[model samples]
Target chain A: MNFDFGFAIVAAVIVVSALFVVRAANLIHAVLWLGVTLLGTAALYAQLNAPFLAGVQVLTYVGGVVTLMIFGVMVTRRHDGIDVVAQTEGADRGFIFASALFVVLALVTWKSAPHVPNPAPVASSADIARALLGEYLIGFEVLSLLLLAAIVGAVVLVRRRDPEPAGEPSPAAAAVSEVNP
Target chain B: MNEFLQGGLYGGGIIVAIMSSLLFVLWTERKMAARMQSRIGPTFTDPLGFLQAPADVLKLLQKEDIIPEKADRALFNNAPLLGATVAIAGAAVVPFSATIVGADLEVGVLYLLAVGALGVLPVFAAGWGSNNKFALLGAMRAIAQSVSYEVPLVLAALVPVILAGSMKLSDIVAYQSSHHWLVVWPFFLGIPAFGLFMLAMLAESNRIPFDIPEAESELVAGITTEYTGMKFGLFYMAEYLHTVIASAVASALFLGGYDGPIAPGLWWMVLKTGLLVVAIYWLRWSLLRFRSDQLMALCWRWLVPSGVVLVVGAAVWVVFAG
Candidate 1:
């Protein structure tokens, strides 16, 4: 198959999924649509001869990030039913803003597209690894430290503030006592 | 054009082989479980109940399909197919022998890890689409469990990649053949990494001790609570396929995949994978399931830290020993 044809298909899928991600009424559906868009972007990465980036895209973005988003959606949802509609207002203004941004992006792309190279050879994982560990070692270490700090912050934010007293009756026990009384 | 056809044929052959072998594996799992429990498993189906797997599949295929009224029709319909497809896709880069692989991408190990991770999406889709509380809970557990275990899984797999100096599965295997199998290398680090890999694999595939997602006693089949007929069959097939793929990857990474004494070939790979599969099944029948809190603690508290240490240890070993 022609690479252009494959790229076109992947691009189309990515664009459609991106649209659906914003357009889907249900929160879960929007998350799923975002997943498709991310996966399609990963496909684009693979087509661009960056398989390692593609894998990381799928691994971290689709798997870890999206799963976390879905878990958050599931947990924070107020309604018990899965059909809860996500409130999405102010579409006209959003659309106007999006269109202006798209226009700017398109203009920038059209102006700078001529400078981009064609058919670049894929950078294998080894080369990327070597560059990260050797040439960009400090930057890589710093980025990891940043991520570690973020994780620590997240854990601290979510952790229970204080342990309940062992002698104190739990909520369930209290509720049962009230009901029985 | 010729390459495309060759690739198609190779992939098709691998899928068929996997499906057929899945039947036998399912039967073997049942028989093994039954033997462990001291019961006559599926004796009425065929000779020694060997045909039970096909029979079960046929029954599932013939059953009337059911879709709940509240379910998201499109996603509910598509989820099973997605699960099975992604599960089978992980096998693409695994080399059965020197010449046998569906696709030998430069980042084969990453490809395997990536594809394995995709199994979570369909499962989440199924759970949400089902519009059932139990299914949603199950899906939530599955996503949490799989995503958490993936950390250690990738880390353990990376030990082999670092030692081999390549992300290619074939290269890792070849590295093992030249050196010692990774499960025996560096004595301390290799064994720990291998054990960690096995634990992560079990958790990733939702096997026993990590199967809180599908605990039948509590969740009633978990995310598959609303599925019926062949849709349910697809989920079953996906689970088994995921197990097999995990075993194949473990074998490739640590057990000297397709490498053995006297002209190593496909059989060695199969034998190693088979042994892992049996071990998984044996553990399934023997071990008790973990509570959700315990499972998460194990992953975050134990496996994750140990995996980091193992990776650092492997890198140090490579620097010193290589």
Candidate 2:
């Protein structure tokens, strides 16, 4: 069997990193290692001649989404050392079985190396612009609507409500009373 | 096959260089932070502490690995892997140069955005798997910030794509080489979109002035507070790598990437990205972060509308200019 050394290394990294991601005890470390695995995938993309995809890999995935995940960690107020065990205990065995299935699939795919046609290079961003705006305009509009909803949802979710009256005047009112009195 | 592999060595070197550059930027950020606060920066490590980063990385690698007792063993391990892997994989599609691109796929931009979006999973996984309330809170906030800012970011970026008229970054660069850079275009919304894109990019990367996720004062490192040793280092690297990519993309989009009077195309691209990185880092320390509500308001009420107008304006320009 002809072994593609570079592919092997990337595959190994992906597997080991995925394992680490699933097994790590610290939640933050899992996130960080996941970032590593994503980076490796970006490398693979580069090998595939998709530099723009690679850039977006970092820009959107690592840059935007990952940072958001980190932000999520804060708002949730997660305890530093607290570890939450899996809610479903048997999930591990299922994951193992899935991994085996995935491995078999991957091997088959690699061996077949399906004859994909080389894509014709376009002139500029105009092509994508035309596509997104012309043919995909409805999708684009829907995405905009989704964004608007997200904005409204976030604002509504985070706004603080006035608490029920505590015994001796609320904090704001008490402060005002003290200042005026 | 051997020839293809041999050809890939150069590609690997480029990746290594890019990664090393990011590591250098991380060190610069720390030193810059210290300098901004009127503190003596790393001066003890190696010849003026230049080797401090390498030393720090080595130390992290050597540190003992710890697992939280209550953590979901699988997801905990998966989080960092997810984070770093997505970062590196996203880096692949960035066209550093015409000849030196990682990938040249047709849907390069879309693939990039999609793959990059995966970054959120690992982050959420970290908090959810750890069963840590603080981590969970941080992860949620990060998600909120990201999702909100992403719209404006994507919309702002679309201006350049509209102007250049392609999703492939190589095509964009080539267009820039042929025509005057998009910045030179006299559309009314040109500069505003650029500004919005840059600001959104900064927030997207979680740079200072937008680093609410890791607000030291409130969250005590937030999502990453529990992480240590190499685990922390990986997160750190991922962040820096994001910064690098963001800066590069911003430059590529607005600053007429690789188009210049003197230097070679690749060098010019690097220079532009480097300068933008410096600016981003400078702003991180110079400005205070906005409150979450204020930040969200800025994105939705102001940035999104402005970005939409800019995109529409670009479309108008395209119709007229053509």
Candidate 3:
């Protein structure tokens, strides 16, 4: 399949699902829509001849991130159907940020490389791996370090604040109980 | 037919074959589990209980379909179907033999991994949509277990991918057929990686010792507490189908799929998959369920670390030995 037609179809699916993601009233539905959006983006990556990115997109986003998001949503809230998801009007900000980030990424990838803005017709995972580790090793390592820092930060944020008095539940646990109850 | 239609037909064919095979597997599982406890299993339903699975399925079909008054209708009705769909979809990348197969994508191994891991979502949806406390609790445990186990599962599967130097299942099998099954070769790395993969596969499939998500004693029917009739049947069938396809994928990766002396390729593939399926059931019947905390501890404290080590070992073996 040539690029444009596949990209268009996949992009359309991604955009529609992403719209549902932002507009769904139920939190769970929103999360599921996000999964569809990610799966579509993975298809787009496949269409773009970046099969490695497509696999990682499906594996990491659909399998890992989406599951994590659902767990967090389920455990922390009464989100089955009783509570409608929150809404915000910062969608314009999101659009601006996404577009700006896209432009920056496009420039970084296109401007620095051999001036071929057109991606190759086919690139296997091994080719991508060699490039990432050979020419872009520093960038990959730094990104991993950044991910490590974020993970540590999350652990710290969720750590117990202090010891509770005997038989007294921690406030965080208490809040969870109240919400779930 | 167009490619889309052909793909659909192929996928539908695989699903039908797998689901029908589940009848045999279901009987085998019950009889095996019963025999392990020294009891007769399902013999009265038919001769040797061969017809029992189909009879039960028919009974389920005749029962009333139910959606709780408080439940989300769409998700409640569709989650089980989604579960079954994900289970069947993984079959697309499974190379059953040298010739007969599904789409042999370049990234077939990753395709299987992604699809296998996608099984967790339906449980979450079913649990939340049921609007029952038991169901919600089940979904919570499921997500936690699936997420934790999938890390090690993916890492361990990647060991074979590294050793074979490709993500394509066909290539991996070809590599194995030409050299050695991954379960035997590479001296130290292959066996351990295969073992770790099996453990994580059990958790991923929510088989015994890792089936806390559906622990019968505490959670009633767990995620399926609110499901009934054919909807529940779909979930039941999807689960067995998942294990069967998982065994197929495992054999394709580690057991020299479709490659053996004298026998036809399909027979070899089927034989290996059958043995693995029986092995999985054996473990289920032989062991007790694990505590929730113990499951988590097993994944994070041991399996994940071993998975990382195995991946590195495979890669290093490739670098020095390949």
Candidate 4:
């Protein structure tokens, strides 16, 4: 309820992790850091009154999407080659200006931020259920339908189009079998 | 009694209880494993292996904490802590009884499911940090299994949620106590829902049969292949904790948690959970490891459909009953 130092530290970690995700050089590193950012956000959401949404965010966004994106990047690239695509060319003056601006914003925020009060007592899950099923039943059902559609779309999108015959396994599979045997 | 649980002190106490439960469950699990193998299990220390967990903890603490010379020492060191911490955070919402729980938050069920779901990150972190081929493969397998099973687990869980008309664990428990256990009234449907829930929990925890991620014969402990001493111990603890929590959840949802004529509240809850744990272990030993493809197909094809049917059936039943 009262602002615990622990929660503040966690908040800082989450914020810093988000910054790292943006600044990290490697795509893999960025994705991993993004996981940290997502987790931090989920924690923050938990601290708020939205544990369900937080769970959904972490499960779907962090757990599902981020993993898929990382796998996609890895599978698409040359596994051995490290291509450091230079996103920010020499912009030292701009970077310094942006840093100064960020510092000012941080100082202003720190100075003016009101003391956060104790956490309010949250509604029980029953309240949420009553609202969803009683009033928002159609919306809930529609959401379910959308989820089904999304799963179908994902299956269609990721389907192996070539239809490779079962008799001829991929070279990697063959090599794996040889080694295992 | 519920008012006391709503207070801060009891909240903290519940945290301590869950943590101790995690430790005690591990000792029990080891003893069980030893018994199954016909070997003496930590009997020399505590007469009945009661203090075995504490002794094991002390041993782990005393072991030389070594970082691999080539490892990303920071990530490698932190990974176990992350795993353990996330696993602990999951306990906050698990309703042990009518009045015994931590943080009866609005999103209780979802919070438990989500936070528990994040166990994959630490698995990946450990795999990637160690930079071992086996750990990587194990980590990948874990992630795949997690994805495969997650759908069914959530879907099956939704049946109770739909029936209870709440995602709160407390509400679900209360609903069960007031009505019969969902298992009793809807007798046949309960089998599929509980079956799907238990199977998914197994895959989620990376336990036997569903434990290809750490398949000893194939992957040499999978994602945790390279971990040693306490770092390894933490992952082990998280796993046991996951198992205990999964069993608690399954029983809580389907088997009428803390509900019986003879036993006290917590005792009733623990007894139900223990029975579920044994059943899970029995299942693990009886079934062989499913091939990853078969595992995926089983979840996607069989469990998911069953889960959907469960939710729809429950929803219909709830409407009519109301």
Q: Write the per-residue lDDT of candidate 1 for residues A51-128, one digit (tens) a residue.
A: 899999998899888888988887777666644677779999999999999999999999998788877776777789
Model 3 residue pairs with clashes: none
Q: What is the C-alpha lDDT of each candidate?
A: 0.89, 0.74, 0.86, 0.78
- Angstrom error at residue B134, model 3: 0.5
Candidate order by lDDT, decreasing, is 1, 3, 4, 2
- CA displacement after TM-score superposition, residue B294 of candidate 3 (Å): 0.6
Clashing pairs in 4: none
lDDT of 4 by residue, B1-322 (tens): 5776547677678767777886667666677777787886788776888887888888988888777787767678888999988877777777787777777765677876777577777877888778788888998888888877888888888888887777777778878788878788777667778888888888887888888888788888887777888998999888777777778888878878777766537788898888887777667656778777768878888888888888888778778864
lDDT of 3 by residue, B95-181 (tens): 888876888889898888888778888888899899999998988888888878888988989999999989899999999988988
Tens digits of lDDT, candidate 2, B109-153: 666566546666667777667677777777767777777777887
Candidates 2 and 4, the one with greater DockQ: 4
Candidate closest to the true structure, highest TM-score: 1
Shares of reference contacts reproduced by the candidates, in order, are 0.73, 0.18, 0.58, 0.70
DockQ for model 1 equals 0.71
Candidate 1: segments with Cα more than 4 A from true spot: A1-3, A79-84, A87-93, A164-181
Candidate 2 versus the native: TM-score?
0.70
lDDT by residue (A48-131, candidate 2, tens digit) is: 655555666766566565565555544454456664432335777988998899999989988877565444243333455578
Ranking by TM-score: 1, 3, 4, 2
Worst 10 residues of 1 chain A by lDDT: A75-84
Of the pair 1 and 3, which is ahead by DockQ? 1
Candidate 4 has an lDDT of 0.78
- Interface root-mean-square deviation of model 2 in angstroms is 6.7
Candidate 4 segments whose C-alpha is farther than 4 A from its true place: A1-11, A43-48, A76-80, A83-87, A90-153, A161-181, B1-12, B22-24, B38-43, B46-52
